[model samples]
Target: MLRLLINIFFLSLVQGSVAGSEPYFSLADYDAASDREYIGAVGILSRPDLGLVITITVQSGGALLLGDPPVDKIPSTAVKRAVCGQVISFPNLPERNLVCR
Candidate 1:
């Protein structure tokens, strides 16, 4: 019974961490977008303990880059180790379903 209780406690911690690790952001549709208009919906940056949020920006002509500051256009292979996810939303347009992956 003691072992079962310990297992349950560890399982809860794992479940909580997984659920909290999801990265969310509302990227701008245009380069001219202001900081106020661009929203990191999850506000992950402030929580450094969560690790760096790898932002893959989808640009015109279907280009992807690290969207975060000192934004660079590089191969995704370089950032394979970073924990990342995408939050797709039309913040400037009509409301639609939010997609996270």
Candidate 2:
């Protein structure tokens, strides 16, 4: 019972650390030649769901500054990474045929 309590305490601390960290979003494109994902755009948002409530557009092929309006918010449901040519679906959004450079 003591060991179990210790394990739970450790897990809580780890979760707290993760929750305290800032969240950011990035866009990646698939490189066909190398068959790898390359980060194209990165942005830090005030909240994950801020994009859902506001118009936040990220133009590809460029890096966003920390305070840029475009990077101020991101979709809460955005994935960390996705494979090219794969179908992606999100809540309240229709499925899309994802194709990246």
Candidate 3:
């Protein structure tokens, strides 16, 4: 009985941890000039000891034009702020390519 209870408790903790680490899909607009689209996975991990950690993994990205390459300015702060599933745009670039959702 004690072993079963301990196993159940561990199972619950594992389930909660897995649930907390699930990644969510978000739109990634690497290029606003083209009709292409992209997708990214955003995941947030939190622990009482570790505070919070945000992770943005690009699942798929759009293609760049022949003469146009990606800009060096990536709005990481804006992306972190907009992680709650909101559209974010980067207006500093001339072509305005870095947009995240």
User: How well is each residue in 22-84 modelled by candidate 1, as lDDT tens digits?
Assistant: 232223243434333333222222114543333234433222333343132222322322323
Q: Please, what is the whole-model Cα lDDT of each candidate in the order they appear? A: 0.31, 0.29, 0.29
TM-score of each model, in listed order: 0.26, 0.22, 0.21
Candidate 3 lDDT tens digits, 15-99? 1222112223334445434523323322222222423222323334432111011111223343234333333332332222223
**lDDT ranking from best to worst?**
1, 3, 2
Candidate 1 deviation (Cα RMSD): 13.9
| Cα RMSD (angstroms) for every candidate in the order listed | 13.9, 14.6, 15.4
Candidate structures ordered by TM-score, highest first:
1, 2, 3
